[model samples]
Every structure is written in structure tokens, then in C-alpha cells.
Target chain A: MKKWKRSARLVDMTQQLLREPHRLIPLSDFAERYQAAKSSISEDLAIVHEVFQQEGSGFVETVSGAAGGVRYIPRAGWERSRETALRLCRELENPSRILPGGYLFLSDLLGDVSLVREIGLIWASFFHDREVDAVVTVETKGIPLAYATASYLGVPVVIIRRDSRITEGSVVTINTVSGSSKRLGSLSLSRRSLQEGARVLVIDDFMKAGGTVRGMIDLMSEFRAEVVGVGVMAETLTEERLVEESASLATVTDIDVKQNRIAVQLGSLFR
Target chain B: MKKWKRSARLVDMTQQLLREPHRLIPLSDFAERYQAAKSSISEDLAIVHEVFQQEGSGFVETVSGAAGGVRYIPRAGWERSRETALRLCRELENPSRILPGGYLFLSDLLGDVSLVREIGLIWASFFHDREVDAVVTVETKGIPLAYATASYLGVPVVIIRRDSRITEGSVVTINTVSGSSKRLGSLSLSRRSLQEGARVLVIDDFMKAGGTVRGMIDLMSEFRAEVVGVGVMAETLTEERLVEESASLATVTDIDVKQNRIAVQLGSLFR
Candidate 1:
């Protein structure tokens, strides 16, 4: 292998770290890849680390000891997260997003890779210290967010399904009702998806009365797992709250379907 | 904006490009962000681009017109993709993964963030140049792959659910058959999910008889969309292939439930 210059090394290291976020890479690995001294690799990492912090990109932590190495933790400052959240709110406040029912048209938002990714990084910034073993979400809308968060956390995503299939082996299913609508629904998870006593961070695209969130929490209990945190992209400002301990990036305080008008606010992440 | 050095600028630029793949970025934006000359930004981009290609990460497109800048397109070389596919097959070949009905347990692979992201990149590399408007997939198991590919393509993902809901307004549903089992199923897509005449790329986790992929192809036609391409993570080796215009990463040529053995080969991607 040819010795890599600092510029090329910086770019390559950044790609590798970003590709596998939250993974520890020993300095020796970089030294071997670049055919450079450990000291030089360390200097390159410092430059990358400083720029990452200044840009509110993420965190780079160095671990000492025989099994020690450096890892990239996806992070965004509270201020930057709040700004992203507010911008998300503004983008969603358009009247055209108001559907026939009280629900908002957010598939586009959930489909926005950049927005979903930023939300993931911001949520990761808040929960990186929680020691989460996995990120969880129900099937459908929440899958993308869960995957994004898991990518940043370097963990797997356990999806709760509406219906259990034979391909996943035996599953644990729970019946619950929507906290606001009283609509009965069931969520299922494969038995092998998470280990017992695993600390899980629950995520979703939207929370209304937090019924689905509550269902996932209830389902996790069946596996003897601990819920470390709950993150949602948007939560409605409803008085009837089923899940209390949760965070959201944006909130819809008012949605007038009759008039095709909607109001959005950045969630408690800003506060 | 602060004037960033080549080292710091390279790190930041790589992050920005990787954050949103397949989206064209204007060079002026980078110049403004770093408060540096366009020439300097180009130099930084060249380093980033070279590293990306050398690392088999993705494509760094430089558009020359005034509206042109540079963008990243996630790509994996055939050798790397085949290796990934073979690894995926080995992971699935476990005897314990054999379900009661001979269906392979694959949710674990789908849940794996690194694996799923790599498969997404591999598939994106094949379909990115097709000018796809969006990546489409059926509900349930296919959502993750759809989202991953959509992320790399910088396009939205359109999920076709088994049942229609009021939340997404009016939807178009179609009844289809499982090409292998001959079971009837219905899939629905939101009217707003895709625009007319969209060139869509369809993706899925597994294709037994390509029934679900066929359903998505039918659904796309409802929107007057063209099926630009189809990609599956794995396809069963069968004498009869319902969908011919498709690509797969891996193939299961044999499965022995009685003896608890299975065989998986790198799909035709190598050929």
C-alpha cells in the first residue's frame, strides 16, 4: 500500500468513520492503512475531530488501554438541533400538508433523507450516553427514523410489526388501543430481535396520544427489556398523553383539516 | 463562516457529501461555507473524490455548468458487493434460520445497520444512473431496504401497504397473487406518493416468486410511472422466475430442512 498524504488520509478516515458510526477504530488500523506513524494519524484525527465539533457534526472519543481505540459518536449541538427542529417545523407547517382527517401528510418529511438523518444525529446527540443496545420502532412510517438512529448508534433496529409473519420465527404480540382514538391495534416483535434486559431506545415518526409508543413499551416488557428513551420526529399537542417520558423534534399544536391549515412548533429538544 | 484549512475543509466537505448522497451540490455553497476560493474548494473536493473512489465508497460527480457543483453517489464495486452478498448468504445459511415452512429467517440481516446500508449502496451503484424518481417497495419487510436505497439516491421511498388508511388521504389499491403460493393479497399506495410519469426503481428484501415486486410494478403503473429497474437483496434460485428484469445480490440454490443444511451462492451479480 502506498503511504497516504494527510489530505487523502483525512478524507478516507472521515468516510470510514461516517460509514460505521459509533464504531471504535484503533490508531494502529489507521497507521497501517496510511502507512504513517501513530503520531501522524493522531494529528489527522485531531483535525477531523475539531472540525466535526465546530460543525456540530459529531463527537470523536479516544479510549486508552490495550483494547482501546477511537470512535465516532453522531452528535449535534442543542442549539443546532433546535434550529434543525424549527426548520423542520416550518417546512411542515404548510397548509397543503393537512390531510382530510386530523392527520398531517408527513410521508414526504419522513422520506427526506437529509431531514431524517439530521433528526437522527440530533436525537443521537441527546441519547448517545444512554447505553442503548438497540433502536426500536413500529413497521411502516417509523422504520426509516429507527434505521437512521441505529446507523448513528452502530446498533441494530428492531421493528415492531403490525402483523407477525412465519419468517421471523415465533414472535411476541401485544394488543393495545390508540390513546386518543381508542382504535385497537396490535404490535409484534420477533423473539430474537432483542436480548433480555437489553436497554432500548424507542423511536417513531409521529406520536398521537402516544398509543403506538405505549404499545412498543408494553411489547418490550414481554421480553424483559428496559426502555431507555423514546424519540419521535413529531408529537401532537394533545391533552391525552399515553406515553410521558419521550422527546420529539417537532410538534403539531393545531391542525384544522376543515380549513386546510396547520401549526407546527419545535418540540422540547429546543427547550 | 470561517476560513477553513484544507485538512478541516476536506473533513467537513466529506461529511456534507456523505450526509445526502445523489444530491447535486453547488461549489459556490462550499466556497461560501469555508469562506475560501472556488479553486481551493475544488482542490479539497478533488482529494475527497479521490479517496471516495479509492475506498469503493461512491461517486463524486462534478457538474461543470453554473448550476453545477459536486455530489456523491454511493457505489460499491462488483467484487466488494459480491463479497458482501456472499457474507449475507453465509449468515443466512444457519440451520436455525430454517423456519417451519422452509422460509429463511432474514429479519436479523435486515435489522443490521451496516449490512443493510452496504446492500443499499451496492444496489444504488447499479441503479443510480437510471434517473429514478423514487425507490418503491412493499410494506413490512421491504421498507428498510427501500429507505436505504432512497437515502443513497436522495429520493423519497414509496411504501405500498397491504391495507389502505385514511391518514394518507385517497390511495390506489390493487389485488395481486403470490407467484409462488398463489395466495391473493392487496397492496395500496398513497396517491400523493409519486408524481405522474415517475421513473421508479423497485427494491425488496427477498423475492420468492417476485409477487410483491410484481405488485409494486403494477402499483407504479397506476401512477403512470415507469419501472426503471428492480433490485432485490436476495432471490431464490427457481426454474421459473416471475420477474426477469431484476438484479439480486444473493441466491439460495438449495435448502435441506430434514438435515438442517442450506446452500447460498453469490447471485448473478458476479456474472
Candidate 2:
């Protein structure tokens, strides 16, 4: 193949490989399909894999054994991750993010880029070693941080939609209460979204009463999936609903939105 | 340096480069800091750049001029992107996402993995060439979709808080009438969060009257940032007043909650 066509084919192959990541493809298959030598196909895969890793968008794992091939792992890189779940406890020392009636201003920080990046990077850094296949989160706010973590980890993100639809093909639905609005809401996951035995990292923008976390825990249980870890952008020390298995970037002690005065204790996230 | 340490250092350097992607860096500087040869540093950077591009996260540009170095350009890759976007438009045609007052039932799709992935990929494809630095959206539902697109493009996401906070450091506030509620509400962006001249991709879950999008547009202008593109999970085509340069995956014609029926039209994106 000529150079430009070869380059175009490389783009097509990269796209196809990314479409079905983590799935095995034999070198012989590529050689026959593209009418190219196995060595040339290998070179093309290397170029695509190198570009992806450099961007921190995904990972390429090549198996050298008899039945081995390249597998794409979508990763949420460090800069985009919320890595310091413990440090969040320190940031929670601040009187702010704590609102009257146990509400938290965490939605504010979750909306912040630098703060969420630090938090996401810290959380992803810890999960880098675990065989986490995907990151999951409830609808609305958690989606942002979840997407960030998923990108860094090079894994696809699965969001549990609050409403059901026929177009999803088939789904498992559950009723649960969210901590933020203190309202009962339904969560649904498509039957095909997650594979059984897949290790999942649960993340959220904030945890007040932990009701939503419990709901997610229940949701994951329905799929028979293991929850490897849980990370939050910020958590309230006031309620201990969530266990040590979960981590947070910032912690909130108090918030008096009525008085418009808030206090935040510095966390050890940057350190 | 040893292999593991060298990999860790490369990861650190990649993170640092991502933080200031617009700035170019010389291989000599990285080599000197790491006490490595220029050739080794170049090899490391090649790996980094490859990873970034393959994942559709970002890019590394080699400047051959007198004052040139490697620069990272955040861009999205087109693996399953067009297919995903087209699928989302088909799914949006489902009547389920429709709600009363011409509202669309997008909250569910925003939470779905396949749906979110397709939506994100589509949005990223549109802004891939615009050099979007951040994704912006209003509070609540829009956060998830915004995060997804931002993740694919490897850009930081800045969320506009519905409520203001002192801990946000300092914020620039704006007021606009939302098409949904039609009530005047205030949206705020932290001064430090957004940079001037940065191209932003605006994403939202649904658009009813275009009030919130207008508010977001006003908020972006307040920061002197550019609106590279706008995307929505669903749009109420019956409602006038769309934010001029916006796009939507699905269009809602009607929502009859009482009759248990919704009317929808698909494929309004890229228009």
C-alpha cells in the first residue's frame, strides 16, 4: 500500500480496534483483511497504541502468548482523576460545603475543574493497580467526576439512568433515595451495559446521607458485579453512612447557607 | 533510571504537560530535569504523544521552526463516533424522553452508558477541530453529558454553579430567563476557573425554551471565552429561541404525560 493509503488504513484500523477494545484480534486476520504483511500490521498497531497512551485516553495491552492479542483499556489518566479521597476529609474540616438541613455545596466544587482534576487524579492513581473494568455513577452530578475518572483509567463509564426507556433494549430498574435532594428516585441500567464479574469503581460528586451510594450498591448487586472501590469528590463527616471502603477528596464539616457563611478545613489532597 | 521509575516519571511529566497543554516544551528541558539523554526523552515523549492521540484525548505537535517544540493539542478521535451519534439520534426518536410542557425525557439517556458514550463521541467529533479547552453546562442533568464529551476530548470541564459560594474564591454571576421554568435564575462561574480566549463546548441534557443555554452563553461571554460548539441530548423543536449556534441529538415535538405518550423527531445534530 502507498504511504497515504497506508496512513488512512491505519486510521481505519485504529477506529475499528477502539470500537471493540479488549477483544482479541489475530495478526493473521489483519494480514489477510488488509492484504498486508503481519509485520506491517504490527507496526500500524504500535503507532495507534503509542498515540493513544500519549494522550492518556486509553491503554493497549498486547498478549504475546499463543492466544494473545491487543486489548484496549479506556483509562482515566492522573490529571483528570480525583485521587485523594482521604484528603477530602481534611477539606471537609472547612465549615462550608455544609448547608442547612444537611445539604452540601459539593456540587460547586464538583463543577470546578482544578479541584475535580486533583480529586479525580488522586482517586484514579489508587485504582490504577486494581483490575477495574469500568467506573459507575448515578445520574446528574456524579456523571462529571465519573467521566473524568473513567477517561483517566481508560475504561468506559456506565451511568445508571434515573428513568427507563424501551430503546435501551432490556434493563434492570430499581427504586432508591438520593442523598442530595432527599427524594426517592428510580435508577436503571441496561442489561447489556455491564458484563458479569466486571470490577467497577463507583464515584460520586458528593455524599451527604449516603443514600445514593447505598442505592448504587444495590444497583451493582443486581448485576452481580463486584464494587472494587468507591470515591467521592467531597463527603460530610457528619454522617458515617458510607464505610472506609469509600474515599473522598474533600470533607465538609458545616455550612450555614442561611447565614451565607461557610467554613472549609484544608485537606491534604495536593500533598 | 530504572524501568518502573522511568515509567512513573513519564506519567508525571505527561500530567504536567496536560496541565499546560497550550505551552510548548523543549526535549532538552525535560531531559535535563530527568537527567536523561535527549534521545531517551524524545522516545518518552513519542510514547506519551501516541497514547494521547490514539485515545482521542489530545495531540503532540512538532514545531520545526526556529522556536518550536512539542505542543499538545486536545482533540477527539473518531472511533465509533459517527456511529454512536447516529444511534443516539435514533434512540432520541423514542417517545419516552418526552415530558410535560414540551420537555424531553433525556435524564434517562444521559445516565445510560451506550447512550452517553454515543452522545459524548458525537459532541467530541464536532468540536475536535475547534480546540475546545473546556466543556460548560448548567447544573444538574447537563453535568453528565458535559463530562462525557470533555473526557473524550481530554479537556477540563467547567460547570456553572446554580448557587454562589464564598469558597469558590470569587465568582462572576449572570442572570437570564430559562425556557423551561421561564423564571429568572442566576448562574455563576468562578473567575479563576475559566481562562480568557479558551474555546468552550456547551452541553446540556435538554433544552425547553433556551433560557438556560442563553444564561450559559451570557456566562461564557462574561469570562471573554469563546463558545466553540453546543450540544444537547434532546431539544424541544417546538420551542423557539434556541441558542443560535447550538445542536441537539433529538428533537421533542410533544409530551403527553397524562396520555402516556411522547412525540419525538430525530437527527437534528450537525445542523
Candidate 3:
């Protein structure tokens, strides 16, 4: 049997096992189907489990007793992952998305967790291969998506509030030029919220000029944390110097509010 | 064996199965442990699966093979159901929850899905013994909770937007007063969103004057949709007009914006 064919079969088997977890399969079954030895099948299962877990999806537990086989107890499923990113791209493409006073229309996207979950999965997928310790997003709108992504990654989400809240405890404050309107705004993170040397994944609902992203970068610098990657549900592609490396679920290229029609370009997502 | 003892054992086994979804067990093992016949075990399993599914909590899928056993998938565990209502009460208990205009500060609860999911589940539990075809909420805050509740019941969520959007196609508009402000607000729903004779679960993030709930009732009357129940994350308990029958996660007794504190009482939610 060809090596690529074996890998393809492995992928197929992995997906099947994921959908229906905890069922034990006899070794003879796979040996007959793949024309592989019991040892070979076991090796393939190990690889499949590793890839899935590394992707932050979940675990494939193997039971070794006579009744035991391999099962995928997914903490998160591929259905949730792929759908989340695709929906973000779709909503970001909307044209009325452009707001006066340099605000962006994200209430629709933030309101939809199905959309946020997919976007979170896509972002997590990008960093699935990368090492990241935590996710950060500004409070209010971005909290839902950030929380969704962190939940998928099995990490805690830290919100950067616009103002100090009694619940958040003490905080560190930073001032940065607004990427959208180019005005000054204060950004905040609770003290003890982030740990030192942690690789932080920054996420938000929208990025106009990347000012908020830049503010997060500054905050990370203040905490001595590492910026692993940046992700946004929607971004104005026209902006510059805001993000060194980033992913946008959708790109808003044109907005004609007078016509109440928005033009959007759907980018690569959810595949 | 006594009937009550057997029922208690069934509940325990049901919970255990729900906690571990992928692990299959043979009926003979359970039958031997309980000193009961296979027929009795089968009957118990049927009732267990039925109640679990009806609660919208999780499920039990049975395998018919000789070696096969029942598996529990803790998809949405009971802890999630209880914690949600508890958390909402905690947030609502804050004195700062009171607004000067007799409004309750429910924006925080509306944006959180975990909390919303719990609130939705509590609502679903009440309607579990009842029937609901859809969930209705006025845009934009109520939409998220409505979606969460609808997801729990496996029903559709119909949004009554303050302003009609062309994307939703033709809509039926009705003018009604908001509860807190006692000010009039328009509720509009797409004509295709709901069907006549459908029973609806009305959900909102906060309630003050009971006007929005009344407005929703009026809108339901227009479509001949039955108001199966009205639920709010928080409410001003002082309101006189009860809006017929309703449930609230939390109740606001007073607000001292001067002290930046709000006082609220927990309502009988899941009860």
C-alpha cells in the first residue's frame, strides 16, 4: 500500500472515530480493511490522536482491556470549528458594517456565538500548530468571541476593559492612539490577569485602524508577555501598521451607507 | 427489590451514564449487579433516555450488539443548567443593578452565552412539561438569550427588531411601550418568522415597566401565536403590571447610582 493512501485512510478513520466515540473495534477488523498489522494500526491511531489533541480539539482515549479500543471524546468538534470562521467572514463582508465616527458594525457578529465559535476555531486552528498560552480581548463586544476561542483552546480568556470595573479588581492602564479615528483612548487590563512570558493570542470583533490591537500589543509589552498571533472577525484591509501578523474572517472593502448596501469580500475561512 | 429503591438506582445509573457518554456497558453486567432481569433493565434505560432528552440536558444512545452497552455524553451537563441560574442571581443581586429610569442592568447578562444558556435551560425546564414552538425577543439585547433558549428547546428564535431590516423581507410592525421607561417602542417581526397557532416563549434581558412583555404579548396576538411563557434575566420587582405570567432570574429592589451599587433579589427561576 502507498504511504499517502495509508495517511488518507488514517484521516478518514480519525474523523469517523471522532463522530462516534467510545466504541471498541477489533484489531482483526482494521487488519483486514487496511491490510496492516495490529502494530501498524496502533501506530496510526497514535498519530491521529496526537494531531487531534495538538489542534486543541480533544483527546482520543484508548482502552487496552479485551473489551477496549480507541475512542475520541471530543472537547470540541470540527463542525463547531469550521462553521465559526466561515460565519465571521460572511458577516464582516456586509457593507453597512461601516459606521460614522469611525465605528464598525459588529453587534450582529458578536451577537452570534455560532459565528464567534467558528471564527474562534479558525483562529485557534491557525495557532493550533503554534504555542499560545492565553487569549486577550477588550471587554464588552470582544469578550464573547475571546471567551469562545479560549474555551475551545481550553484556556482562560482575559478581558481588557475600557474602564475599571469593581469586579475586575486592580488594573494596569495604557494610552494609545486610536487606529480608527487617530484619537487617544485608554485601554485596561486587570492586574494579575496576565502572567509573564505567556504567549498571548489577541482577539477582537473588529479592527478599523488596528488601534485596539496596537493597544493590546502595548499592554502585552507592559506585562512582559509574548504576542503569539492576532485575530479579528472583521478588518478594514486598508489599515496599515496596526498588525504585524493577523487573520481576518472577513474584509470590509466598501461601505455605501447612503445606499444602505455594503460590499464585502469573503476570504479564506472554515476549510 | 422495592420500587423506590429501583427508581433511585435508575437515577444514579442514568447520571453516571450521562457523565461518561462513550463508555459502553453490557446489560448483563447491570442486570447482575441489580439482581434484576434484562427486561427490567431495558425498561429503565428507556425511561432514562426519555427524561434526559426531554430535559434538553443530554442523551443516552444504546448499542444493540451483544458486547455493546449504553454510553453517556455529557454534552451539556446538569451542572451547566444549575450554575447558569445561580450566576444570574449573583449578578442580579448587585445593588448597582438598578437604573435611574427604573431599568435593570441586564446588559451584562444578555451578552454572556454560558449564563444565557443556563437561563434558557431553566426556562426550557419549566416549559419541558409544557409546549413551545418558538422563542421571541425584541432586538438587540434579547436576541442572544432568545437564540440560546431556542437552541435548548431545538426550536427557532424569532427576533422583533426595533427597526425592520430589508434582509428579513416583509415584517409585521406593532407599537408597544417599554416596561422600564414606560416609553413606546416598535416591535417588528418578519412575516415568515412565525406561524399562526405556534406557541412562543418570550425572553428579554431585563424588564422594568412590563411594557415590552405586554408588547410581545400583543405581537403574539397579531400572529395568533400563544405566549407559552415570558422570561427575563432581571426585573424590577416593584413593577405593578405583572404582564400576566412571567419568570425572572433576578429581581431588582433598589438602585443607588450615587453609591454605584444596585440591590436585587433572586427570583424563583427554575422552580
Best by lDDT: 1
lDDT (Cα, tens digit) per residue for candidate 1, span B39-143: 888888888888888888876889899889899978887778877888898897788888888998888889999999888888788887799888888877887
Please give the range of 10 consecutive residues that has the lowest summed lDDT in model 3 chain B: B2-11
Worst 10 residues of 3 chain A by lDDT: A2-11
Chain A TM-score for model 2, please?
0.62
Candidate 3 structure quality by residue, lDDT tens digits, A204-255: 8777778889899999999999988888777666636577777776676666
Could you give the interface RMSD of each candidate, to one decimal?
1.2, 7.9, 12.3
Computed on alpha carbons, the lDDT of every model, listed in order, comes to 0.87, 0.66, 0.64
Report the lDDT tens digits of candidate 1 across residue range A1-271. Answer: 9989999999998888888987999888999989999999889889989988988888688999888889897788777888889889998898987776577778778777778888888777889899999999998889888988898899998988888888878899999898988989898888988899999999998898999999999999999999999999988888889998999888888998777778888786665
Candidates by TM-score, descending order: 1, 2, 3
DockQ of candidate 1, scored on C-alphas against the true complex (2 decimals): 0.80
- Candidate achieving higher lDDT, 2 or 3: 2
Question: What class would a CAPRI assessor give candidate 3's docking?
Answer: incorrect
Best by TM-score: 1
- TM-score for chain A, prediction 1: 0.97
